[model samples]
Target: MPDAPLTQVLAPDVSPRPSACPGLWRIVTARDGGICRIKLPGGVLLADQADAVADAAERFAGGVIEATNRGNLQVRGIGADHHGLLDALLAAGLGPREAAGDDVRNLMLSPLAGLDPLMLLDVRPLAAQLLRMLETTPRLHELSAKFAVQLDGGEGLAMLEHPHDLWLSAVRLEQRTWLAFGLAGCPAQQRALGAVPVEQGLALVRAVLERFLDLARPEQSRMRHLLDTCPADAFVAGLGLAIRRDAAVLAWRRPASRAKWLGVLPQRQGLALGVAPPLGRLTPAMLRGAARLAREAGDGSLRLSPWQSLLLPGFDSARAHEGLAELAALGLLCSAGQPLARLVACTGSRGCAKAQADTKADAVVLAGLLHQGGPGSVHLSGCPRSCAVAHVAPATLLARAPGRYDLYLRDARLPGFGVLRATDLTPEEAGALLDLPTEHLDD
Candidate 1:
């Protein structure tokens, strides 16, 4: 249950322009038909909204709704009725306040942002503010749909490896709370370029975005792309703002978050439940059931995690097991150590033309062959686009052809799915090698 009904909300009279990315209004044409990506706020979607999405998918487009790796929803196989589909979603209060603001709303927070017991800060307020800035500011519309930001509240359940164009983390120096800001990399790996007082968050974001737009060419879509040409230090030095780089702020680093994503997560006040649809594909029933559970047992809202799961926060911890039981009934993977939890697969030949193998169908066979969870996470991509995951997974099984793959292990010395461990292995061979429970693959 969100604070208010996102009811028939039309983001004032604005028409979104055409782009490669999909939006409520600008449905991008795909091999299937059209694609519409619904960006959930903090990845929170209400039960009513879920129902609305389901209805829209069934009536106005093809019934194939996809749960994106970034925790948003995308509907594929759209027919000629794209406008009708957009209207249905907008009527459900799923569209942005400004049509231009749709793609710019890429901000990721931990699913348990406000509720996580081990969090240093509750990021709800700042997240809301930053979202507003990106939405209402007309200049930000010039940014690419792929230009994204991350806000780490220091929650134990945070996703830290995903690279962001602009990142901010909660940090304490001396006796005061400040936000450490960086550009072109994730908060976990890159050192903070500067810090700003918590109160200046809006101004800080404005400055960084303005600087990015000011310097970047249209061809450079992402911050990292621009940074490739312009040195990070030169880019930072050009920002005409007072940035604090003292030992107190610069000496800090974003600490590691607990990797447990699916299960009952403890909250400061009560409890929150995290669950994922297997391989992130949800039947309409599964979506509706989770939404109903969120409304009845927890807060009236559901937060979607970057791990391709959904969370219901503010539930009574005493009733957690009861809620967990209900979630399990919805065909969601709740337990962390489950074999399917560690395996990720893209929409292979079943959905995309470039795919040689049906990765989703093959993932099922591979999961059964593996028989158990291992020390690392594995991504099975049809091609190398790696749509199911944004960050480099601990292990990658890149499909070469039908039932054949190239296995890559997580190696610090390499990039893009890490070191190539083996090639041209059958699914059984991959399972034999990946089933080993050795040292932790990633910290």
Candidate 2:
């Protein structure tokens, strides 16, 4: 367990390393009000817990709850009752295992980590162990909240592009599961930097994080930033652990996940239904309805996705389609062909002070225009911080001023939102351009 509350341990004057990113304690003020983020373990939320969150948002906030990109939830427009809201959430078992563990609880796993039929291994056990180590290690608390780790268990349905500070993907060699790891990159785009047998996976993660904290400057909060100065080979050598860096292991590339976040998905055994709250904001009613469905038709749990969505797992395949219809009827996007499902927007001027345009409102407009264009992912940023997306989307519309934006397409050769393809385009113009073939824009 961690020491005292992490918020108290830091010098209050330091103000969370000068970042506006929201954590459980550091509720960053926005145009709407104070935003309190609650990090859910393994993206699993029990039925009662979901109802509790909805109640907190309605009672202590402006009744606006957002499912975060990192598979968490945030209560927006929070009033003066921070403690009240915190108490309500804790009463629902949403707080960190220990107070000091809150800020560093950034770990990514597939929504179906344990239940996926097509996965090579069940990641829940290792995930629990790794999370415990991250919380117990006091030194790791110094790392930025943005610093994250990903544990991929070869699940057929997983988000593979979101780069993590340290990423480990499960691979089988000689009929035994081994964890292939890389630094400052994603399993889908980068080759494995090294591999460790499954038993050594937890230790490898610990070593890598500890070593990173030992050498990185305070400015280098991300692994990519640290790698710019530190040599990767030297960093690996210093781990002092037996790592298999053979040609075969180093050359391994993770296959892209063909799984879709919305619609019906076949598990190795049963069926699972995926859903997205429109624009990542969940109405209290929508949440309550989903929670009811989870408790009745499916497992007693809900899985939040990296796509800023949620899923009802362990569902009866015969009733899965019916459940999807129910969720869609509640204004949630449940089909891949839904236009809003392809659009992500940050809290803009309506809710965030840094925003120039109401990205959420504009996203709706863009979605209407792209209604018949099939599913195409687009991100609308209130400002350059890009709070709504953890990974690069196919297209990004950076807000320039009210009702206007400059569009960028994701290009491997370009950094930051990718290549700037159009400037000073409104949502209407961007929508028109996006309606063209997917090849027209870089992804």
Candidate 3:
């Protein structure tokens, strides 16, 4: 389907329930300025599109582009010229197929969907069908902007931790491929409610969504909310389609993926270079430089990962190092060993009113003090919201006041940022504590 023009899609007033989240049409106001989220299809951004986003950010917004956790890009600190920013994006074919479809296009796929050497299936084709179904179907538009679905191809570098309203993973059964699905959870921690033949994947998705719409009240915006009252078994039974619930399907669990997203990554055909913008914030120059490298040395496209990074696929194995060098020179984090690369921080007091501290700056300071042998990942959140990360990190620094935070270590036995270990500690104190051996921190 062709994308709707900016003029045709600007009427957010017509919607029954307006979204607070930033969309192509709905520019949400914030402490800095305005925010415009460009929902990319499967996180695939072409070189030209990347250039357009850079130009748009530089022209009409604070030149800050963010790689969102949902595998999308958002322009932050936008100025008064919302229409001008929307126009430049739309002209680059960034808008949805229909005016009402903008907020409903929330499907996620692996960054290496088609090229992963270990993938059991290529999920791109089915992902395209599912996205079109979500966008073109007006009934689905009534869904919340936060409603999301994940389609996993069993890639080695996949993000299986982020929870989704609905998730499907490719599985091999009886010499045939099937999609094992669950509701209101992630594949890494949730059991599959049922399985459907690969051919019926689309039909299964449509059935689940339509059933949700039929059963949900206006207040129950997310699938988890509805499941709190309705049983998962009852919901699956009502899908009105043949589903496999046998032991083989029910006991299937997605294997934990240990593949790293930074530096050179593996692809079936060629090497891929993965780089991240420090603290998930990308400047116009960083974006433009990555796009230029993609056009020159890669497949002319960049795939954003759920880890708040970008991957340039299809680079020759020999040129991967050189390509990584170019990206590193442009202020992109090309190696995971970089201290800043291991740290994740939200927009602190500078951009969010709720933030108690400047988490971004604090992260930089904390990164330098970090030792090489502590927790692999640490998340610095301005407040309890922890909006920067969908999944809890190995260690968390929750802000209590300016430059002071409470430390939490991720423990599955506890909930909400895991077990709180210390409180009212400055970054220096926190760094000293974090540098302790793993056994000591665990104790």
Clashes of each: 3, 0, 0
| TM-score to true structure, per model | 0.93, 0.94, 0.96
Candidate 1 lDDT over 1-443, as tens digits, reads 55332223543223454466777656776667777889987888887999888888888776777778777898888888665777678778896745788879999888888878877778889999998888998999888888888888888988888889999998887777788998888977889988988888778888889988998888888888888998887887777777888887777889887658777777888878888888877777778888888888888778888888888888767778988888888788887667777788987886778887878887777777664555567889999888788888888899999999999887767878888889998888888888776563532
Residue lDDT tens for model 3, 380-441: 99998888998888889999999999999988888898888999999999888887768524
lDDT of 1 at 151: 84
Q: Report the lDDT tens digits of candidate 2 across residue range 91-152.
A: 68886635566788888999989878779989999999988887788877788888899999
The residue ranges of model 3 lying beyond 4 angstroms of the native Cα positions read 1-5, 12-16, 439-443
Better of 2 and 3 by lDDT: 3
What is the full ranking by TM-score, best candidate first? 3, 2, 1
Candidates sorted by lDDT, best first: 3, 2, 1
lDDT (C-alpha) at residue 71 in model 1: 73
Q: After best superposition, candidate 1 residue 424: deviation in angstroms?
A: 1.3
What's the CA error at residue 53 for candidate 3, in Å?
Answer: 0.4
- Badly placed stretches (over 4 Å) of model 2 are 1-19, 373-375, 441-443
lDDT of each: 0.81, 0.85, 0.90
Query: What RMSD does each model have against the real structure?
Result: 3.7, 3.2, 2.4
For model 2, state the Cα shift of residue 24 in Å. Answer: 1.9
